[model samples]
Target: MPAKLTILTNGSIKVEGDFEVCDPQGGVFNVAGKPAVFLCRCGQSAKKPFCDGAHKTCGFTSEVKASA
Candidate 1:
């Protein structure tokens, strides 16, 4: 399946399907064979690129909408 990203309300961005996360330097994240991943959007995650559920306690809020 193609990569899909779902931004959660007041939380992390849900990532699914065939995908691999890479940093700006071309380093790849070890997400192989995983069903999904929650990426940090709040910028409060100690896990950096991954979500550790910090948004729940950090008072993060965002409502993103797609442009038509």
Candidate 2:
């Protein structure tokens, strides 16, 4: 399946299908064969680049909208 990314309202980015996640240094973060992944957007997750459900407590907000 083709990779798809969905930005959740005021939350993390939901990614599905075949995809690769990499760090700033070009190191790949293994997903362990998982079919879906949620990425941090509020910059509050202790697990940077991954969602730790911190947005709920961090008061993160965004007015930007994404188009399909």
Candidate 3:
């Protein structure tokens, strides 16, 4: 299945299905067979590009909605 990226309101980006995550240096980060993944957007997660639930404490906010 193709991957889908969903931008959450006031939260991280939710990625579902098959996907590939890579670093700026062209190194791929292993997903370990996860069907879905949550990416950090608040820039507060100790795990960059992956949500660590830091938005709650960091006061990240967004009102944007996902469209079909």
Clashing pairs in 3: none
Residue 57 CA displacement from its true place in model 1, Å: 0.1
Q: Please write out the lDDT profile of model 3 over residues 1-68, one tens digit for every residue.
A: 89899999999999988789989999999996898899999999999989999999898999986569
Those runs of model 3 whose alpha carbons end farther than 4 Å from true positions after fitting are 66-68
lDDT of each: 0.93, 0.92, 0.91
Task: Give the 10-residue window scoring lowest on summed lDDT in candidate 2.
Answer: 58-67
Provide the lDDT at 62 for model 2: 73
Clashes of 2: 0
lDDT (10s digit) by residue, model 1, range 1-68: 99999998889999999889999999999988899999999999999999999999999999887779
Better of 2 and 3 by TM-score: 3
Q: Could you list the CA RMSD of all candidates, in the order they appear?
A: 1.1, 1.7, 1.6
**Candidate order by decreasing lDDT:** 1, 2, 3
Query: What is candidate 2's lDDT per residue for 1-68, written digit by digit as tens?
Result: 99999888889999999899998899999897898999999999999899999999999987668669
The order by descending TM-score is 1, 3, 2
Model 2, C-alpha of 1: deviation from truth (Å): 1.0
lDDT score of model 2?
Answer: 0.92
Best by TM-score: 1
